[model samples]
Target: MKARVTVMLKNGVLDPQGEAVRHALGALGFDGVEGVRQGKVIELDLVQGTSQATVKEMCDKLLANAVIESYTIEMA
Candidate 1:
């Protein structure tokens, strides 16, 4: 089995890295680039019987910062 986690910053939090990318895009002649937000994807190889509950617990403990970020999980 495999799993994926997508983690992103919550709205209203400043994303300096994303902002920098946006600025660079404009400087490189990419016009009308209004905004940019950055996020991460984590791919996991798991045992066949690993439960969604366990995955959620993993996110709560380590994968995401609950105070400022959110995460979604997909299993395959």
Candidate 2:
């Protein structure tokens, strides 16, 4: 079984790295680049029969910082 997680900062949060990327793109003449935000995708292979609840617990405990970020998990 596999789990894929997408983690990102919540809206209204500042993203310095994303801003840097946007500025770099503009400098390179990549027009119409208005906004950009950065996030992370994590993939994990776990033993079969792992519960969604456990995965969620993992996210709450280590994968995400609930104060400033959100995460979604998809299982296969």
Candidate 3:
């Protein structure tokens, strides 16, 4: 089994890294971009039959900071 997790800052949170990327893009002449929000993707290899609930538990425990970040899980 495999799972992919995406973690991102919640709306209304400050994202300095994302802002920096937007600024850099403008400087590099890709001016159409108006905003950027940075996030992370984590791929996990798990034992067969691993459940999405288990993956969610992992996110709740460590993969994401519940107060400021949210995560989505995709299992394969």
Candidate number with greatest lDDT = 3
In order of listing, the candidates' clash counts read: 0, 0, 0
lDDT of 3 at 76: 86
lDDT of each: 0.95, 0.93, 0.97
Candidate 2 lDDT by residue in tens digits, 1-76: 9999899999999988889999999999999999999988889899999988889999999999999999999999
As a TM-score, model 3 comes out at 0.98
TM-score, ranked from best to worst: 3, 1, 2
Candidate 3 lDDT (Cα, whole model)? Answer: 0.97
Candidate 3 lDDT trough over 10 residues, lowest sum: 47-56
Best model per TM-score? 3
How far does residue 52 in candidate 1 sit from its true spot (Å)? 1.2
Give the better candidate number (2 or 3) by TM-score.
Answer: 3
Per-residue C-alpha lDDT of model 3 across residues 8-66, encoded as one tens digit per residue? 99999999999999999999999799899999999999999999999999999999999
Off by over 4 Å in 2: none
Which candidate would rank higher by lDDT, 2 or 3?
A: 3
